[model samples]
Target: MHLSIIAGSSGLVGNNILNQLCEDNHNVIAINRKPISGLHPKTTELVIDFESFLIDGSLPACNHAFICLGTTMKIAGNKNNFRRVDFDYSLDIAKKAFESGAKKLTLISSGGADSSSKNFYLRVKGELEDAIINIGFESVNIFRPGFLTGAGGRKRATSEKIFMKLAKFLDLILIGSARKYRSINAEVLARKMVSTLKSKPGVNYYYYDDFIK
Candidate 1:
């Protein structure tokens, strides 16, 4: 069984990934800002300030590190705070995991990520991808699913819900090269991320087709 460390254990995609990891009976170290309950018996959770942890905390040895940490500009209140969560905190955890001897790394990125993109959000995602790739893990998996859904009970704006419903219809029409832009469920993407950890060395990017497959 793998001993893995997962950051962002409280988000939609991250929470699902955590569940999958625990259900497989793998040993998990879940890091979050606050404590969470109802986790599997195999999971251990840590609550701490990310910036402080990065400066002083060290991780135990792990085979894989999964980073699902991210924040939106709106919720973050500004771009700097958004980057601190999405880029700074995420990169710091990856560094700690590497120092702890993790061979594989899995990250939850987004569709349309490009470092040189004019879009700020996509640019940050792309920059994070490049930074993580340079960490020299034995294997790296980056999932870029668009329009993620399937985290139940969270309040969403009505327009957002409508767009999600629309994604189902669009999924059918987004064929061929466009299939990568199709919407994917958070749980589906999490399962794919967990199953592919043993992939061959080198960086791998997964889109909607990759997750659904």
Candidate 2:
């Protein structure tokens, strides 16, 4: 039996991936701080304090794990809090998952993510990507989507909404290499991630163009 574990199952992309996995009849373990509303035969909800996840003794062995947990500085309230979620919590979970026998791990990252970036958010994401890669999963697929559009009751700041709207409108005009910078829907991203499970053992990177494909 192939089991899949998803962190941040309550978020937009995570929720979509959880539902997609269930629909594919894959057994899934959903990890979240709070309960996610959904009922599926192959779904197991694991609610826990992310900070103490190392000692939780509840992690189930899985074939693959998806890291979807993320937050912004505004919502996290401070730079320290933001780094805790985006960097500390994610890397810790990745390490724990790696030790749990998950052969493949997929990360939902962002475009322009660079550990040496001047932007705080991008730098944090880049750092997490680097750390996870070093964990040495048999297969590590990093998806760097530009802007995401989807419905999951996820709250977005005014500026974010404006940017999303602009990206959505501009998506139609983006072609060829330009598509790599276009906005992609959350559901689409989830579907692609699941579909790519058969990928060979190695680290792979996907950008906006890859998302459209």
Best by lDDT: 1
Candidate 2 lDDT over 63-127, as tens digits, reads: 88899999877799998999999888788878888888999999999988999999999999999
Per-model C-alpha lDDT, please? 0.88, 0.86
- Top-scoring candidate (TM-score): 1
- Give the per-residue lDDT of model 1 (tens digit) for 95-204: 99999999999999989999999999999999999999999998999988788888642367787789888989988988888888888888888999998667888998
lDDT of 1 at 90: 96
Q: What is the C-alpha local distance difference test score of candidate 1?
A: 0.88
Poorest lDDT segment (10 consecutive residues) of candidate 1: 151-160
* lDDT for position 168 in model 1: 91
| Residue 149 of model 1, lDDT score | 80
Give the TM-score comparing model 2 with the true structure, all chains together: 0.92
Per-residue lDDT value at 121 in model 2: 94
